[model samples]
Target: MKHLRFLNKYFYKYKWWIIPGVFFVIISNIFGVIPAQVIGHAFNLITENIQIYGLFSGFERREIIYDIFSYSLLYFGALVLVLYLLRGLFLFFMRQTIILMSRHIEYDMKNEIYAHYQELSLGFYRRNNTGDLMNRATEDVNRVRMYVGPAIMYAINTGVLFLLVIYAMFSVNTTLAIFCLLPLPVLVVIIYFVNTMINQKSEQIQEQLSKLSSFVQERFSGIRVIKSYVREPYTKKVFAEESEGYKQSAMSLVKVQALFYPTMLLLVGLSTILTIYVGGKQVINGSITPGNIAEFIVYVNQLTFPVSMLGWVTTLIQRASASQKRINEFLQLKPEIISGKQEKRAINGNIKFENVSFTYPDTGIKALRNVNFEIKQGQFVAIIGRTGSGKSTLANLIMRMYDVEAGRIIIDNTYLKELNLQDYRNQIGFVPQEVFLFSDTIKNNIAFGLDTVNDNEVEAAAKNAAVYNNIIDFELKFETMLGERGITLSGGQKQRVSIARALIKEPKILIFDDCLSAVDTRTEEEILNNLGRIMNNKTSILIAHRISTIKNADKILVLDDGQIIEEGTHNELLQKGGAYAEMYQNQLLEEESQSV
Candidate 1:
């Protein structure tokens, strides 16, 4: 009933079509009931030995036969014509209604799911499979559309037909009608049990299918790495196992379906046989006329179709229920980060972190502990740390990807939480460690967020990032199409493009998280020098492992185990012989030895 309610609103919008379609359906069914009357009346006319009237009522016996033939042809022809025309009309509207309903539901569902994704914290995406989200957005929504479109209409039609046949049978002969329906109660019970089993099995099948989709997506995306590591056989073996599980689950569902259809057929057939035998006896005993018996038999057969369709409807409902449950569960997930109910705040990039502590949602392990930092307006600050030292976590906090457990982060003298997230983030730009680009032209990627920007500004940003020459080398230049994830570009080119994209935003606060790692030392130096000039008065945060990357910064912070151990200029840190001093000495020795 809850799922049905979900479809009601959309159904109402197209009720005009449905109402007419249903009226046509009823007209077709009424016409279908006529053939039985014709059969019974012809029998009576023959048995009674009556002088059947001709077309004019005063005609020869040959004319009488011809009249009967013509009347019979007209009766049958009218039934066929009405049924064909009305059914075709109804079918057209029904298809249109279904398409309209499915498209509306799909559009709404996709937007709702995407909105939820946008609200959810980064932790949710990190723990969940990308393919699973894709399936929920695409496959699950489609399944729900199937239910809304075809399943609902079929359910309605089946119910109408079942009741029509039952009423017709009762009107003809009550005793025989009751006897014909004796198997119905038992059949209902059996169908209920089968439907329950089907729902359970179908849910499992869909879950396994989701897993299979995820496996395929993961493998395909990482195929390069798998081949590079020479793990083809191992990956194949894992995928084979997942595929086999999906196959086995599907077969299990098939087995249940096979049993259900046969049971339905047997029940319907038995009811039909009962109607024939009992009604035949009634006719011979004069309890009812031959015509009545003939009509009863026709009605009984009519009932068979709806009964048989019950199995298919049950299967559809089961699949729909499974899909609905998955979609509901996804919608119910609460994002780890919550948006505040306040007006948008104007930012000038004065950031201060006071006693911040953080933990990942999945593991609840502390990623940062009592970390404190501050950057005055328009300052160039660098963060240096070993791997897993919570350097990225700090950046994530500043970006508000995850909320801190205990602390306050202030931006431009306002609490971070008391600002509209989208508007606040619009003032900041981040270039992550691993750059990702959409499969679009280079120009669009650079000006992604903005609605409109001149080509001159885009060119300027590209030149500042030192990738203008590379872009011009290609035939399409800025209009060149990059393959998926920027696969057409080398690693260094992709990184520089990402940098240009972030820089073009002209954000007040710019973050480069290991963005220079992929380029050669000379290239890295050139980019750093260019960035220094571009960021003269703009607030910037540089995260890197190399001392040279942070050498020109106003201040550098050395982090170890989530806490800042040292903070000073590069020369000041080297003179102290601390953690920063030790790292600098090692890199200096390595560089000198390589040069020799």
Candidate 2:
């Protein structure tokens, strides 16, 4: 319930729905109980007339008495029909209010959770699985909706019906009422303990269901791999095992649920039996009329459905509590990354790292150690390094994905953290080693960096990336849609499309983190030639392993083991004849031998 308390604000926010809904609940119950009273009076009318007609059997007008009794009964029947109709009408209104409010709250809850997910840092995503996040937003929110809607509605209905029915019974005959209600307290105690079991089992079911969903989601995401590796049998066996576990958990909950209705009806039946027995004695002793017995029975039966809903409503609420607790786990978390409040400013891409050091938070690997570098605006800088030489780490720091631990980064003389985060990222175009594209049209994918774009601009960027010819060869051209992660395109095509996405922004700084590896050397040279023409006035940083790619860079930095070992123009490093020169001579030999 402490976790369930998170929804209290929603209850307050939608109070209008609740207040009107409560009014209708009370009104509907009032109308519902009135019919029982009418039936009682109608019974008494029939009995009294039966006595009259019998006494007047010697009279010549007994047929007239029969007609009078028939008319009176017909009127009472119509009145009872109208009463039930009114009750049903109010019930509809009750649903319109309370149930409708629950849907609104569901919409709000999902958006709130999704927005929170967006604000969370990369570490948060790394720590939690995608399926778990999705389940909390969707399935868990649905459970909470049940508590706010149907469970609350039924609980209110039961309470109001009990009050009205009990009052009517006691008013008629206190002794019969006392005896009739004796079975109810025992019913409560039994349901209380049963509900405890229900709560535990329901929580277990929810947990297992999350796990099952995660398993299925992960399998589908890697379906291609599973099929390619011919491991379908293995995956199928694991899926079957997970499904069996889920079924067992569900059946356990169902078994507990199965106990609810029968036990509920049985106790209600006992109350009915008590009513007839005690009520018959009262009638024989001249304490009440036979009509009073009829009325009491009607009242008890009126309470029957509401009382039966006890277990179901309790089960819904219990499950909802379990779900809300899971949701609160994420809702209560403060995002590790908070955006700066600084206003947006123009970026000139003069980046300097002073005494910078960083370690991966999750892996605990020191990626950069006391690194210092400076890149002036509009300079083409290239970083060449081995596989683990911290090339990608430098690019990530420039993008401010993670804050520096030891030293500060300055962008155009402003502390990197002091600049607005969103604004800062918007001015830079980054193409990572692993390119990711959305499942959308080529035009949209190329123009994704901008809020609004035209076909001409998309084409221009595509041409700049040397992918325009490939795109135009398609029958649908720019309108061609892609599959998941742009799977419809070849590896080289995907890389070019990603490059077009970054290029369309006309950013102040462009960082290519070995994105040209997928393309042939000729295509790479063509794309780099376009970059030289288009990005002549903007800072460009290209990270690659090929010495040929960085031969013409204004400044080349060679990194090894998280530290820069050499920095100079290609010709200057050649003069030094150290690590850079040795690598250059090796690649030259490899290329010359391949030509032979």
Candidate 3:
């Protein structure tokens, strides 16, 4: 009951529907027991008027007995018929209203989970896998729905029917009724223990499912790498092992159910035996009529189904309990990144990193050490750093992907933390080295950042990125749908499209974090040449390894081992004979060698 406390709000939300549904459940079950009582009375009526159906038509017959038997049989038939009608009607409403409400609640829960996921910081995504999250949203949500819908409905049905049948049994013969109900407490104890085991097993099974889902998702996403390495046999073996673990968990649950249901059935069967023996003796001893024995038997038989159903309903409840616990654990997590309450104001893109030092979560290594730099509005600054020298980390900080651990990042003379996060991010455009595109039309992908797509703006952005000519060469042009992550396009084409996506935003500050690495030097130069006009009067930060890409920028900062080693123009760095000069020489030599 405590585990189900999370669903209190949903129950309150749908109480109008749920209350009527529960009412129907009670009505249906109440009607359900009427048939058994009617059958018993019909038997008693026949017994009372045994001579009414005499063999000879001319035999002396009691007219009143004949009329009473005929009328009683007709009335009993009509009573049973009407009860069936009411039972069916209420059952329909119970299932239609309650089960559908559960589905609606499921929809709301999934949406809520997804909405919360969007609000969580990037660090959370780094710690969790997509498949595990998917399992919680889909399979776990479905299990919760079972608890809210069928398990609740059936539990109520069992309770109502049990009470009605018990009263009916006592009315037939109190002693027999008491004796027949003696085994129910033992059945309850058995159910409680079995339910505990089932819950533990269900948790294990759900965990295994998450692992298997993660494995399949990761493998499929990297199938090309696996195929290129010819590792299918090894991957298949790993999948088979995971599948076996899942099967073992499932079998454990099945084994518990296999034992539990039969035990319940056996107890119910014993209760029926008790009723037959006790009632038969009472009849034989003249303490009750033969009709009383028949009626008691019918009442005890009606008790069998609800008693046996206890095990199944218990399984639903425990499974839902286990799933709800998992979901609540995720829901309880509060995001580390909190947005500011300030309203968005105009930004001039005067960015400054003042003595910034940062370290990643769960790692002792400082990714950036007292990094100090500033770019005035409309300044073109290039950061050239070796691999692992914290260039991307700087861009990520500026994007507000992670906060600096020890220092302040100021934008437009205000601390970055004080600005509204969404509004701040909306003013900046970013293109990362690894590009990802949705499976949508080329036009839609380019215009994805905009609230509304303007065809003219999209085409201009594509042209500025130098991918427009190649796009128009296709038969469908901008309307063509891309494959997953734009796999159908070449590497350079994909990067250009990503650039176009950023350019369409017309952001005040544009950070290109080695996004042109895949393009050839010629196309890279052409795209940069076109960007000169678009970048006018706007601040731009170019992070790259190629000296040619940033040689013409207003300023260049060379980084090494998380510290800036050189800061000057291209010719100034060459004259100083520092790290940038050496890198330029090596790159020139590599190019000269490649030509030969």
Candidate 4:
């Protein structure tokens, strides 16, 4: 019922097209059955007139036959031509309306799903697999469209054909109709069992396909690691296992379909044979005219078509139902994150974390616990911590990526949740450790977040990030197209491009989350110098492991185990000789060793 309601919205939106298309199905089937009656009547007229002319004495039989039947033959031919032409036109309208409506609905559905994905929080994506989502968006959508267009159209056509043919059959002789339809109960029993099997097999096939797709996508995304570790054979083996699973599921579905179609065709043949035997006896006993027997045979042939098509239509319905269920699961999901009613257009970036603590979903361990910090507007604050010390987690909380499990983070005296999500995020520029670049021109990537791009502003941002010279060295300069995830560029270059992306936003708050770790020391120093100038009136938070990057900051925070053990100027932290001093000394020794 839920699935039906979800699909019904689309049907109702395009009801104009669907209703007329269905009406034409009825018209075409009515016209279709008329031909059967016309042919039977013509055959009877020819045979009966021959017997009547045999009693003529003054005229030759041949002359009487030609004179009596030539007009009727011409009339029969003309009537057939007109009827068939109208039927063909109706079929064209049905296809144009219903098939096109299905296509439109598919387009609308894909867009809606994509929009919904954007609305979903990061936690939703974390819980779902990319390839599985892709399968639901694409393959499942196509299957539903097939149900709407070809499956529904054919089902209706078959139904109308059966109804009109059965009426025509009963009109000629009720006893013959009863005998012809005797195989229906046996066919219904077989179809009921067959449909159940098909439904189960279809669901298995779809699940196996999603798993195979996810396996391939994950393997491809980590191809670099696989090759580095020489795990090609192992990866291939796993892929083969998944592929075999998909193949087995598909064969199960095929097996059900194979049994169902043949069984239906056999039953249709039985019904036709019975109709012929029963109608022949009625003609011999003079209970019905020969013309009526001829018409009954035509109706039997018409009925056979729908019965045989029943299995295929059932298969389509089962597949569509399964697809609808999957898509509805996505559609029904409400995002865990919701925006606040407050609309703050300008944020001063006075951030204060008051006893904030957070734990990731499905994990009992806390990533951050009772962390406290405060940064005044336009202050240069740097956070230094070891791996897994919650440095990144703190940054994530500042950006409202996830709400803290306990306590609250405040910005400019307002709680983080109290500000509008979009308006709040727009005021900050964030560059993370893992830089992602799209497969587009460099200029486009830098200006991606903006509605319009000014070439000069992009170049200036690139210069500020100390990568302007690198851009000009390329043949295409700013127009150079990047490969997937900027694979064509070096790590340092990708990081610089990401920096430029954040810089162009010209945000009130700038965050660098170990973004310069890949760049050479000389380039990193130059970028920091330019960033220092840019951070004059904007609150800047630098999260890094290297002490040299944040040594000159106005204030430094040393975090260990989600607690801030020390907070002071860089020189003050060194004077205290705590975790911050040890990290700085270790990095200095490692650099000296590398130089030697």
**Model 3 lDDT on a 0 to 1 scale:** 0.88
| Tens digits of per-residue lDDT for model 2, 298-379 | 9888878988888889889989999998998898898765667889988998999999998889889899988998999999
**Alpha-carbon local distance difference test for all models:** 0.82, 0.91, 0.88, 0.87
* lDDT (Cα, tens digit) per residue for candidate 4, span 1-596: 24646778899999999999999999988888898788778878878887776767467776767776888878987897899999999999989999999999999999999999888887788788999999999999999888888888898898888888888888878998899888889988998888888888888888998998998899888889999999999999999999999898898888878887788778778877887788789889987777776777777777766777778778888898888898889988997778789956798879999999888885665788888889998899999898988888888888888888999999989888889999888878999888999999999989887888799999999999988999999999999999989988999999999999999998899999989889888999999898888878889999988888999898998888888889999999899998888998999999999999
lDDT of 1 by residue, 1-596 (tens): 46545656656776776676566556556655666666666556555534444333665676767667677767755765665576567656666665566677778878988998888889888888988988888887887877776777677777777777777778878989898888889888988899889888878888988898899899888888998999999988998999899899889989988987888778778877887799889988898887776677777677667777778778888888888788778788997777777787667889998999888878977888888888988899999989988888888989999888899999888888877888888888899998999999999998886779999989988888888999999999999999988999999999999999988888889998888888888878877787888777889999999888888899898888888889999999989999999999899999999999
lDDT of 1 at 231: 95
Which digits, one per residue and each the tens of the lDDT, describe model 3 over residues 177-291? 8888989899888888887899899999999999999999999888889999999999999999999999999999999999988887888888878877987898788777767
True-vs-predicted CA distance for residue 23, candidate 3, Å? 0.9
Q: Rank candidates, TM-score, best first.
A: 4, 3, 2, 1
Over 4 Å off, model 2: 582-596
RMSD (Å) per prediction: 2.8, 1.9, 2.0, 1.8
Output the lDDT of residue 390, model 2: 95
Off by over 4 Å in 1: 1-28, 42-63
Candidate 4 CA-lDDT value? 0.87
Ranking by lDDT: 2, 3, 4, 1
Candidate 3 stretches with Cα past 4 Å from truth are: 51-71, 285-288
Error of 1 at 487 (Å): 1.3
Candidate No. with top lDDT: 2
- Report the candidate with higher lDDT, 1 versus 4: 4
What lDDT score goes with residue 343 in model 4?
58
